[model samples]
Target chain A: MITVRCFATVREILGCETRTLPPSSTPQLASDILRIVAGARTTDLPKPLLVAINCEHASLTSPVKDGDEIAFFPPVSGG
Target chain B: MIIRLQTADFDPEREAQALDVKGAGARVSFVGTVRDTAQDRRIEALEIEHYPEMTRAELARIGTAAQTTHDLLEVLIIHRYGRLQSHERIVLVTVWSAHRAGAFAGCQAIVDALKTRAPFWKKEISPEGAVWVPGQTPQDLR
Candidate 1:
């Protein structure tokens, strides 16, 4: 299973805070996971949406593995 | 190095005085407070959200990098999250060093890095509505 989390506006738009996806067709990368989560709402995602794997800031192309945690969110604005 | 991610407010004077300074001849501190307005909109509050584990790690990275680049004695970073009213304190950064230059530069470097590198999101609640700040990490870091 791949653990997926969303935060900030992304969470608000998706209406989901967390989700679990069983490995199917092997979603091999962070972008793949995003595609699944986005579904038909691709256009709603942030233009420069951010991704993180296992709590470290990462890119969409970062590889994914079973049981890994993935996060999607808008750009950070904190100081 | 000391890093704190808390929902409670902190006193800058108390935090600065609490640092264990030995040979430090200078101490520099920075406090960030929420503004009452953004652009022309009257801001009501700021809602801050963060990835817990990542926030700490990124802060540590920034603190350590600042220390590496300067001659420092101590580093302390306190960042508050959750709903905050306008004019409330949002963050504090303090650094102690042997000279004024190192202390000043180190503190500035930490604050600059924190602004872009930390995994924190802020939403401004104004009279109009709540909106997320459209800031992102640089392309290389993302």
Candidate 2:
């Protein structure tokens, strides 16, 4: 299973912090899971989300594998 | 170079004194504090979230980038997370180099990089309610 993590606004929007999705025979990209979250949130894919695969910056086109931790959130606001 | 991510508030003076000061012609230190207000609303505190491994990775990357881009002698970074009150220091960045220009430029780069690259989310707490700080790109920060 691939674990998905959401933070900040995305977590609040979905009312969930984590969701484990069953790995599919076909390769799953980060955007695919993001689509699911947006659907669950009852929103039309709000704004662009910043993605990280296993804690590293990744794009929507990045691939996902079983046991991988994918996090989605808004752009950073830190210093 | 040094990097520290902690929830405990740090003493900037103590940290500054701990660094090697000899052989450096210039030093620049920056401390970021939580403002009491944002968007005309009073902010009582901020709750911060971060990805542990990711925070370390990105901070290291920013440190290295600042060093190479600005040619610095030393670099230091400290960031705090968790519930924190207004006026509390949120981060500390220090840069040392043979010249003031490099120190200034390197420190700026390090700060800017941290704001955008670091995987940290903050929420603003006030009388109204706790609200997530709106996110923006690095360019928009300025």
Candidate 3:
């Protein structure tokens, strides 16, 4: 199982904080999981989006596997 | 080093007093507050959202980086989430070092890195409506 999470503006765009997907046999990348989770709203996501796998920063090309929690978020704006 | 994320407001004076500043020759504290206006629009409040574990880890990373880079003796970072009214403190970074220069640099480094690195977002609640503040990329990242 892979759990996908969204934060900040990305959360607002995705309309959900977390979603868990069933296990997949085929090899999947971060982009694939993001595309699968985002569905048709992929283009609506905020620009310069960031990805994290298992709580560490990652890129779209990063691999995804069962038990990994992937996160998509807008660039951080904090102080 | 100390790091905290809380919904309750903090008293900087109390926090400073609690720290063991005995050995340090210099101590610097920075407090970030919610502004009454954002981008020319008057705001009623600022809503801060942060990823639970990720935010903590990132803040720790920033604090450690500052400590190493600036030779800081001690560091403290306190960030608040949820809705905060104008003028309310949003974050606090305090550093102690053998000299003023290290303390100053360490505090600034933490603040600068936290602005772009920490996984926190601010939304402006205005009379018009709520809007997510736009994201900013550090010059080096671009």
Chain A TM-scores for all candidates read 0.91, 0.86, 0.94
Higher-ranked by DockQ: 2 or 3: 3
Which stretches in model 3 have alpha-carbon errors above 4 Å? Answer: B138-141
* Total residue pair clashes for candidate 1: 0
TM-score for candidate 2: 0.90
Candidate 2 clash pair list: none
lDDT of 1 by residue, B3-87 (tens): 9999999999999998779999999999999999998999999999998888898899889989989888999999999999999
**Model 3: DockQ vs. true structure:** 0.75
The clash count for each model shown is 0, 0, 0
TM-score of chain A of 1: 0.91
**lDDT (Cα atoms) of all candidates against the true structure:** 0.89, 0.86, 0.89
Worst 10 residues of 2 chain A by lDDT: A37-46
Judged by DockQ cut-offs, the docking class of candidate 3 is medium
After superposition on all C-alphas, the RMSD of every candidate to the true structure, in Å, is 1.6, 2.5, 1.5
Clashing pairs in 3: none
Model 3, residue B64: distance off in Å is 0.7
True contacts kept of each: 0.66, 0.73, 0.77
**Model 2, C-alpha of A62: deviation from truth (Å):** 1.7
